[model samples]
Target: DHTHLKKALVFTNSRTDAEETILEMRRMAAKRGERDVFHVHHGSISAMLREETEAALRQGPGPAVAAATLTLELGIDLGELERVLQLGAPYSCASFVQRLGRSGRRGDAASEMIFVTPEEEDEEAQLPARMPWTLLRAIAVIELYVREKWVEPLNVRQLPVGLLYHQTMSILKSMGEAEPEDLKEAVLSLPSFRGIDPADYDAFMEYMIGMGHIETMEEGTVLIGLAGEKIVNNFRFYAVFKDDEEHVVYNGTEEIGSITTVPPPGYCFTLAGKLWKIEEVDTRHKAVYVKSSRGKVDTLWLGAGGDVHTRIMAKIREVLGSTALYPYLAPSAAARLERARRLAKESGLLTSEVLPAGGDSMFILPWAGSRQFRTLERLLKNNLKGRLGLRSIVPMEPYYMVVAGRTDAETLQEEIIA
Candidate 1:
């Protein structure tokens, strides 16, 4: 509505969310007589389109908004950015800092970021369902950064076995062929795979050869096998991360976005936020033709939910147990926090290890991180399966576990004590 709102970037955690935000923003702007001022920029977008978006922001007369994903997080020059909006608590401290740094570069003007997170919804008078974990996490991360400047370190795996397999085929294909000893030296030389031992590599190669990922030539050199060449020849094989099979989205000549699943024609779906009807789904081209339609639709992308860190988990527990009011919380957020604190106290989230769910299921609040939660799940599944008749051991990371099936409080106590 104001001319001062020249350029702003809203960052969402997923590509789908970015597109959805773009669609919604455009709709909202059009209502205010602003047209074609909102755009989406993500990796799935075409290079030319993305560059056009950058160009538009660089030389804008009126206001323009870009709903973006992490593609824009890495110091991309989107000119005269007056503000940054985080649609959720950033996945990490580093990301929070990166998104915040994108604004207010105009000579002594202050940079800004507005974090907008939804409070958990109430349903069925569910106990502890009212805990605003996302909000608590955002608070914890901000406080931790302010207090200790804590940031999650880069987690580099020692034995990147999956990557090693890909690299081995890629290297051998690029160089034509390499002997066993040569292959070992070449892969080990990579800093990413430096921790890999030659002995383990030998086993890997043997397995790959048996699996037809590699074939031994006459001079004891390994060449790409039938299975391997098919992969390396494709341009997509350059990336180390595996991708879900995607169908490219198109609106006339323009590509809107991509999705792993394809919905049929007249099946409503959302991208960039207005309704889009699938006009044509060309599986051969791996492209979907879409047309703008009426109504809203739910959008989803293929990806796993993020893992909760142990430090954040600990912080949430502390937040629950303490009465210290944070200055940063909004009115709704503060009220939600007060409600959650009360619920935690009454429901024994801080004081008791075991609580009862509505059914025969008993809830175990072991404030442990994912790994511990998973181990406990396995222990319950395998060790105590027959003895306790353990039906399910669901691992709700950073919170609690629900152990059900003919189990009582005494059984859980005895099992833990023993």
Candidate 2:
């Protein structure tokens, strides 16, 4: 708690983590007699609240902590922050570096980041649980940046059909009406839509027209239809990314933030680093009214995992294979890594791709990225299942897959080779 008074930005991977983490932080702050010190910021929150949180962090006379996701990771100037805290392993080295750059922006001060990797307490540990995956990943990311100056390359999406459609609707909505050729030129002139085929766009426009999203006048001009107008007129239409329907949470008349779902009356929920008891649910306006309450409540938010590069996975494998200890690791973390390395050595996982997992089960270490691992899984289940006598195939994703089959390790490996 030495840095409790230091202004910091606590980064989480998702909105749910941001909410929960802020709640926990607020609880701890309350014990220290701190009030209105913790704030929450994420995409789901209202723009006004997010701006307020940004302002709080940027020009605070006293220490104020903001628990946030990537929404606060880059772009905004939060002044000179004393520290950056990451809740879990960041998905990429680029992300790690971007977050690390948030601190120590003034003068010659060195940037500081404190990674908090939470370990699960399981009485009966599973094979995956035995290894410190999060710790290893955090180490690998740091090493990759420090040692090799390597960051995962950005993989830009090629065919952004959704963005294209969004732009089309926006253009039509703004221009009111235009000839098909003029509309085509206007939409396709944008750099993002440069790769899109004109013929394909025509086909898409025809489909949209048929679906009532656009209308064609007798004069051969195109305009936004009632359906498209409904979409274009909404505030959310500006965003091209997929957004889930969320209910706005309000403290009396003041808007707190938005969540994916609203609880019924008498239910308690968390938002913007504070707990509230649901007094009423406004279904028509998609809002929730609440009053300040104590204790704890968990709220659900939708999240998805990001893709891990094969290079990072290879670095993880190297970390497991080597005996070199990372200086940044604490004693407990070093001990945990030692145990994991010992297990890896004993199970021959470092050198071998296949390892025995108790009776009638074996592990296949693909050491590939998510997409590659999924492809290998399909190959095992669809193509190699019968040949290898595989009964059940379960994947832990982007890592090793466990399969329970009749065939032995040697036979399974040999069969896989064939």
Candidate 3:
């Protein structure tokens, strides 16, 4: 490789992966007689080291590759990079495109990215491969950019009831006391909390006071009561999400890392790319301390999961319907799309206006993504469920719906259409 093609970035999702990628790259460089060419950057690394690496990359010319996590995804201007490598599939389309945007600066012909998929032979490994065509997604993203020259607007409307819960306690802890009106305004002013109704805000305060989460003093200030102090003093309370449990890491005598939750005993986990054994737990501290181990384990979290926009699903259906093929699609992505199309055609889903899944239930595949599905789901739940005798509703991807009870497909269709 030319010395001028020196500076590169290898991005990974996890901190451990970032460090391991850096070590492996350095080892490879040594074999090629370029041992000093790459560096590692991640949150766990010292700030001084991160600064030094940034300074060196800014100087440029001598070959250097920084194995990084999301830390390098945003700011920290390092000029233009010559090449970028993604170690695995980014969790979202938005994330994948953002990392791709980082390279090919300084008038290089076009940015280059090598998405390396790690070898895994398990059911979990099949999830990404089975997911809707990603290469087609990449193509769609690029084509959308070329056709409309627009990026998806950010969603800033969700009421941050969770964040409000955290901030109220934080304000009370930090400032000792705050006037109820002032407190309400402070939270309402945050950009993330926009569109929150004033009545709901008042209700939240009432709930807090009734529940004894906070106290109202005669001086018109909201103070942290016993319950509030107990919550805010705990370290796990720092984050907005309510933590279920805590895990601590102990390197013999030293505490290295802490996790909010821990796996059951004898289970293996990959953090930072190496396997670890959870030898002990300190629940009081919400920590699970572990030691090095061999094997792989999947991380599971509980939640309803991410939303898929109705428009994106509609586009996926369009891709299926059109005879046109995306030349840039990788073989795997192409095969997945073909299979999805075949399934749609076989089920008569492509042309059907209304799909009846089974007796007493109907599904209408609108080819909409998650957000529209959710919005539609809510609308149906409110207006149609009781009247139509709809017992349950579930939406599966690629625009398939599950409707239970006595649901008149034609009526639902008319409702949706009208």
Candidate 4:
């Protein structure tokens, strides 16, 4: 049963998925009469718990596995891991490589990763539903990285005004007091601020002073003001992005974690890889009291999805169109791909870019990527809506555009070309 893999890391896309996966893992362990060795590590979880999980994986006597989001993607030593597992396709080849590098760290053993992608099967589902988008994405990511040695290119932020403000406040706080010219020089000398013009810097300083974030003395020196001091002294100041007002959770005397919303008493939720039943809600203090819970509960949390590159989208299209077999696919995955390919060919998706959907609807497949898809979507909704007598428009991004209207294919083509 591969018991030699005593330590492993399970990477997921979001915090909610990580928590849910660990909860399932604990359930499976409980059924086996084994110790619950699963833990969760994410940004929302307390740093102390995360560090403790890391230490447990490094030194715990028994088996240990941690389900985590991007919090564990970066460099953090957890000794030598025997396995690395991913729930679905990673956002990019760079992410794939980073997660893969975490395993098989002993001696000359090569790193390895296992991808566990789940696909739904429905007898009455549509053609698009049958297509294995996640599988295709995984193949594209792997082929692009392994065969072409190509990873998504980095795009540096052109305007980072928030970071500029943070750096300015931090420098002023450290310096206590600095001349106006000295402060400007100190903030602008950083490499991140090299593109900023002196005039722009001066304007930002004026704005800060106007907002009472900085104060000027008779000696022509600038110092952090009361407002700026309040911001700089907070523990959350180190984060570049704004965090939501969160309520802390406590399990009896032990601190658990924080969440954005607090449900009324008697709601069960999952946190830190364990279920918790809410006993009391202290709205004034913004603290939640909970005890251990065994019942299943569905909890929702806010998170952002990763952006798909145009290249990766094109690669997915290629995978869909081509008949080449991928050896990495399991038997079930291979069978799913075969079914999708058969259905795609029969539906004329391989030859025609436009297909009629029932009486008045049509699907326009541009075979383009995210940016191109966005442009086409805008054109249909904004420019050609009234001209085509369009009744409705549905956009499935980076894939196809479906519109129901009285216009025929010929006129639609003419309008789109024009």
Candidate 5:
């Protein structure tokens, strides 16, 4: 009831989803004869609109719900909240815990959270070698938090080149032209740029000059050149990563939402749990205007979302070793696990304790976290090859490898140690 829901925050994974959800909530509120008290907040939403929504939420009472992305996950104190709802699996455990902490502020008994994973039936789906085990992973994350309070450590080892480029332009724009040494010190001293090396900074300047992104005057002052000006002048240049070519979805004159990488005219796709047909494309302004329709097509980005945790991988191994049977193990999940077990046994990975899939140019399934896995990949690329005739290698996650040539396991092991 509206009386019970003093204030609620619903977290969605994407900007489009956030927009769609707020619309649905408002419609439901209208149906119940209640006030339209829902706010949408996401990156794509205009700053003025977001500010208005935030102000409304702060003014309390009357069951105001805010549908938001990661923008609201951080330390934006919303006073007391009745509950927080997560739409699906959060990208990480830290994010999940952060969202959960938003509720129960006003000394209420306990905060409440409802994690909902909207299901879809795919008839022609070929499942994994072991079911995703998302439930187990979620449980494990909670258990680990209770026992050891583990939060995944952030990796800042590699300097973010894209961020560096952004900061360079920002410094130039803010402080006007600056001397090369002074510019280097200004950037290197910043806390966020601590991972960046002074030498790399020098190389960056050279790259900028080569790419016509920056220029040095006769007076030896570094300034944002023509190319840099073109980039910085654009609103999209404020963001570090590349933005997808998206079109604005509108119902008449009202902007409903946005879609990424527009499809050809007359093509339809599902977005925000609704179908849309591209009506017009404004290539000059990089916007697509669309209208709503019915019928479903692949809409979600099939990009590599994120990496699985080492603990989760370890737990998957433990699941295989144990005799317990999970009731939710769908037929596909069961078959996949069996297949993995059979492969594991055939390769003598279980008993021998050897990294079973070994050859002169084999892939190593360390079950290590992404950072460690990447480190091993780099180490192998640097050390092996010329010494052992090992050529190309590609690592497929969980446990699979593609090797270049045929060589004995013992020799590979020796080379790995050396």
Candidate 6:
């Protein structure tokens, strides 16, 4: 209730959730007879509205609460925000830090973050109900950051065919014409393309020529071909990553928003606050014509998925296996942990490292993380299918696997170990 004076920046995974959060906050404020003051800022919002929200956030000590997606996680400054709250599971360790750093920018006051974890269900699903994966994941991220200060290394570029294709076109467009060897040296020498070999470059250029993205002149120099010229001349060619040409979405004369792709007729989508159905699409102009229609539609949200580190998954296993209680957990979180532990013990999970389900089914606990577990799964499914007289071998990630066959859990464990 006292959050009015907090001057907070709240973050969620998707734009729809951000907008919905602000909407809910507005409703709460209205009930209390306070001004409905929460605002939303994301990529698709109107430029004017985004600018106004940013200006208000940067102005000063007044109540400026903005709920946003990762649009605010970058270098953009938004004055001295009092609180930074994370509403859902953060996608990565790097993102977690970026959102956390937004607060505590004001002098020695020390910035603050509040994570609101939802309550877990009691049903005996695949994963234990008590060990909330969301909360444990949050803890695991914090642990990784503190212990190793580790972030995922950039993906290796063994064959950057996409970038190579893009850059070759760019170099030709910029220099207009160059020798094949000279072009290879020029394009492949760049840091991003340095991994590419000259032979690969030659092959790529030859393919491009064959495909009409490049043309071989009589002088042995290469120039952009007719097809390549069409691409380079278009504004979309300069982009590193591929996307649809900017399609402006309009409801009648007024622009609701714009997206990379235009929906076909009768396809409904959510934009701003309400749903709209596509009326017409102009491919030549790259415009999506729409008209208002409101029932329910799937929210449009673009998010970057993260790969869980082996170390964090190991930490999650430790949390479940150990009796140590994390101090950061609230009472509810503590109870959740306790129930999970109890379930594990009652099922003979921690003691025998295996438990029974019903019929011929058994759960085998393997503390190894995803990479190892995946390898184990492949090993069982491929190698041990006939050797151990095994009927089935299943590998569940982050915890245990369900293995059922004629063999008992103990005998199977011995056989697998042997």
Top TM-score prediction, candidate number: 1
The TM-score measured for candidate 2 stands at: 0.79
- lDDT score for residue 146 of model 4: 81
Q: Show the colliding residue pairs in model 5.
A: 247-288
Kindly indicate the candidate among 1 and 6 with the higher TM-score: 1
Candidate ranking (TM-score, best to worst): 1, 2, 4, 6, 3, 5
lDDT of 3 by residue, 43-162 (tens): 544455677768767785756778787788877887767777776545445665678778767775586676655433243422222335444344454555445564566776477677
lDDT per residue as tens, model 2, 1-418: 6348878899888887888988887777878787767789987777888998899889967588889888887899999887789988887899999999998788998887988898863637656557777888898899999899999886877778888889999888888999999989999999998888999999999999998999999998989988888988888889767678788888877888887777789888777877889998888998888999987687766667667788888999999989997888879888888888888887678787888888999888878888788888888999999887899999888778889988898888777767
The better-scoring model by TM-score among 2 and 3 is 2
lDDT of 6 by residue, 1-418 (tens): 4357668888887887776677667667768898655777778876766777788788866687888888899778788887788877675678888888888887887756777767656676653434577776777776667567976566586887888888888987888889888888888888888777788778888899999989999999999999988988988777676664467778777765677655678888766545678889998887888888755565555543344556666676666677886776778877877877777666665566566667687777665655577777777788776776668766546556787777677776776677
lDDT of each: 0.77, 0.84, 0.65, 0.83, 0.65, 0.74
Q: Order of all candidates by lDDT, from best down to worst?
A: 2, 4, 1, 6, 3, 5
Tens digits of per-residue lDDT, candidate 5, 190-220, equal 8888878788889889999888889889999
For every candidate in turn, the CA RMSD to the true structure comes to 3.9, 4.9, 6.6, 5.4, 7.0, 6.0
Candidate 5 global CA lDDT score: 0.65
Worst 10 residues of 5 by lDDT: 123-132
> Against the hidden reference, what TM-scores do the models get?
0.82, 0.79, 0.63, 0.78, 0.62, 0.70
